[model samples]
Target: MHEMLGNQYFLIRNYFEAEKEFEVGLLSDPDNFKIKKKLIVCYIQTGHVDSALTLFHNIVSTDPKIITDTNPEEDNCPCPEIIYELESILNNSEVELKTLSLAMLWLYCDLEESIWYFEQYYQFNKSTHIIKSILASLNKEINK
Candidate 1:
């Protein structure tokens, strides 16, 4: 039911509503990859990059093989389309390097690459409190 409504909202480009429904669905079934994927998209559309990145990390961390495998029975595995969209976002010029690091982490890129991006962003934008806060959060999360 929530999935269907979320799909409908997504089709209409009403990403906020879709996000809400998907989040609600996830509350009941935290392991539902399909809903998580949809919620990721919603986060992207609504500029909730941090949330999207965190969820993406959680999803991949839960099943690293999902990044490459495509077994039909594995409904939790992300589809190629979602991967492509995420990659596209990572490549977009408007996306900050910190955000790119999160996406890179999601794609299972070298941890060093993510750290490098974050460090570069921090070095260049030290005045940005959000970046500082994000760096602190990332550091804590990565170290854990």
Candidate 2:
């Protein structure tokens, strides 16, 4: 099964291979939360922040508490590196990346910051149902 092979790749830090396998695995079992979670990890490990956020929004829309790999000790976590990278380019006219970086920053740096970013994003894109759902989930998470 793709998930089995993907697990091996994930364990070895072959995130690209793991990502491919997980993507395939999802095609057959779209609701397999485990695969989607791992795929989110793979997306981040591969520097596909947009992809990771898209998938993350999908999962978090239903359960906001599932923000994955916020721990610095987690294997190959690039969140800190990403945050660091953002400092140099945070104001480089890449609106999406800046907002996405904020989303990521809260995972590894400050949870409240993510809420602020999500709130700002919502103000500009109120029609985005996914952002609304994510914002609600973030509120739910903070309230708990």
Q: Give the Å shift of residue 68 in candidate 2.
A: 5.5
lDDT tens readout by residue for model 2, 1-144: 999899889777788999999999999999987787668767866778778888888877767545543455554444556667666676678676577646755554566887887787677667988777777887887788
RMSD of 2: 3.4
Give the residue spans of candidate 1 off by over 4 A. 65-94, 97-144
Worst 10 residues of 2 by lDDT: 68-77
TM-score of each: 0.52, 0.69
The stretch of ten residues in a row with the least summed lDDT in candidate 1 is 68-77
The lDDT values for all models are 0.60, 0.73
Residue 25 of model 1, lDDT score: 85
| Cα lDDT, model 1, residue 13 | 64
Clashing residue pairs, backbone N/CA/C < 3 A, model 1: none
Task: Report the CA-based lDDT of candidate 1 relative to the real structure.
Answer: 0.60
Per-residue accuracy of model 1 over 1-144 as CA lDDT, tens digit each? 888898788666688999989988888888888677667767866778778767766655565334323342343323234445655676557656435444434333344444566666566667866555545554555566
Error of 1 at 85 (Å): 9.8
| Residue 131 error, candidate 1, Å | 14
